[model samples]
Target: MKVIIAIDSFKGSISSSEGGAAIAEGIKRVYPDAETVVLPLADGGEGTVEALVSGSSGQLRTASVTGPLGEPVDAIYGIMGDGETAVIEVAAACGLPLVSPERRNPTLTTTRGVGELILDAMERGCRSFVIGLGGSATNDAGIGMLQALGYRFVDDSGHEVGEGGGALARIAQIDASGTRPELTSCTFRVACDVDNPLYGPDGAAYIFAPQKGADAAMVEALDQGLRQYARAAEAHLGHDIAGIPGAGAAGGLGAALVGFLRAELLSGAELVLDSLGIEAQLADAQFVITGEGRLDGQTSRGKAPLGVARLASRHGLPVIALAGSVGSEASALNSQGVSALFPILSGPMTLEAAMDPKATAAHLQGTAEQLFRLIQATAGASS
Candidate 1:
């Protein structure tokens, strides 16, 4: 019997490979001779770089670059096994975690480091890019990254505007004559699950700035600033991507990428799964096991586990998903391809206790054993 184990990282607990290993061990207990393939899974968020690097036998390169508050931060990117595909997560450069809660001001954060990472990868001969736009700490509409990439945003006096979202309103001119020439030869496929427009109540600043430490007043100001930036970009670049889907992602970085870089925004889960070639892996597999930290209504909204489930179902494989927590709404996915959703908890425990790596692994193993045992029994009964 062949079973594929593709579990997402239980964030703050066990990693993807670690969780897969534990599940493999449990499956072995029921079928000692079963073939189990454990894969690293991610949905283009924090663990994307690590997952792609490990899954594709890629190498990680770290570089010191400008952080959200203009501080030095070490950002890591991945060069896939082909050596031409560069995988980058926006969080590595300007995530909320990089700044303290007290200093969390989206107006003053920057995504300059993200551009520097791209430049560094391009210098290394990587022309194919897979950028993950998630967990950003900026609302600058990606001007900071554009600046690092040699796009000049100048005020009426021709002086270059500074970094941060607050500076978006000061741009009167944009000069792309200095951008890297090699960028014309590059292709960018951005893993973005958000669908916010550039500016408005549903736009980037209004939807995401609060988490980056903006108050009500600051959100209004940042939203207005994004409007100004979009107007300037439309006038100067001659393209209006303000109302595009995912344009509000990562604080208007999506707009910048779509307008200037010509990036294709895609679903994070679908993008990662396609990169891993899930269809080919499931060709002869008898069963598929996948999971994430939690299974809720949001899980059905194009999360990694849902992606796996859909692919496996098409191949006529039963998909069992094991999650750390299973909400009532998760049951809705039963008809949507996921055969079953099981919680890993064996007994009640505190959140911290449940998050311990060893404990989570143990629960995963125990849950997998019982679930697979039932599967075996049902198979035997039918036979």
Candidate 2:
């Protein structure tokens, strides 16, 4: 029997690689000769870099970069096993986790560190960049990243505007003389799943700023600043970036990468599966086991587990979804190629207890054994 285990990180509980390993170990207990391949996946959010690095034989590199608040933070990016592609997660540098709750401020945050990482990879001869734009704490329309890449945003007085979205209101002329020429020779794949625009009632500021510590006033200010930034970018770049789908993601960092970097924006789950070559692995597998931290209506909205199910279905393989928490009409997952949705919590427990790494790991293993046992019973009865 052959089974492929592809699962996302359980968010604060287990790494995706570990989750796959636990499942594989369980499957082994029931069918020791079962061929299992583990591919840890990410949906372009936190831990994306680690997922990619762990699944592929990749080299990890770390550097000091400016954080969301201009503090020094250690950022990591990876060169994939193929040696030509670089995988970078913007969150590693400008993520919300770097700041305390009291210090979260979207208006003042920047993607400068992301740009620095990109530049660093470019210098190391990585030409193709897979950039995961999630978990950011900025709404600066990627101005900071642009600045790091040699684009200049000057204020009304022709002085270079400082970092942060708050500076977008300044009268500006953008100069792109400094953009790296190597960028033109490279391919940029932006991994994003959200479809929000950069400015509007449904845009970045209105939808995401509250989580970044914005008050009503800050949201309003940020909305206006994004408008200003959009106007400036449109005047100079001749593209309407604000209204583009996924442009508002990561505090408008998506728009910046798309408009300025000419990145091809794609669903994070799709991109990760493609990178890991899911289709090839699914070819002869009898069953495909996939999972994530939660499964609900959102699972149908392009999450990693859904991605895996869709691919598995195409190959006529049954898919089982294992999750930490299955909620609110999670039966809807069946429509997305999931045969059954399994919640790993064995008993009533606090969220903390349910998600405890050690406990969750053991539960996952046991769940796998149960699944294979059922599979074996059904096959025997049918025969």
Q: Which pairs clash in the backbone of model 1?
A: none
The TM-score of candidate 1 is: 0.95
Worst 10 residues of 2 by lDDT: 45-54
Best by lDDT: 1
Candidate 1 residue lDDT tens string, 138-216: 9999999999999999999999989899999888889999999999999999999889999999999889999999999
lDDT of 2 by residue, 1-383 (tens): 99999999998899999999999999999899999999989887776777777778888999899999999899989988888789999889898888899989887888899989988898988898889987788888898998988899998888998888788888378999888888888889989989999988999999999999999999999999889889999999897988889999999998888898889999898988888888999998999999988888888877899999999999989998999989977788898799988998888989998888999899999999998998889989999
The best candidate by TM-score is: 1
How many Å off is the CA of 61 in candidate 1? Answer: 1.7
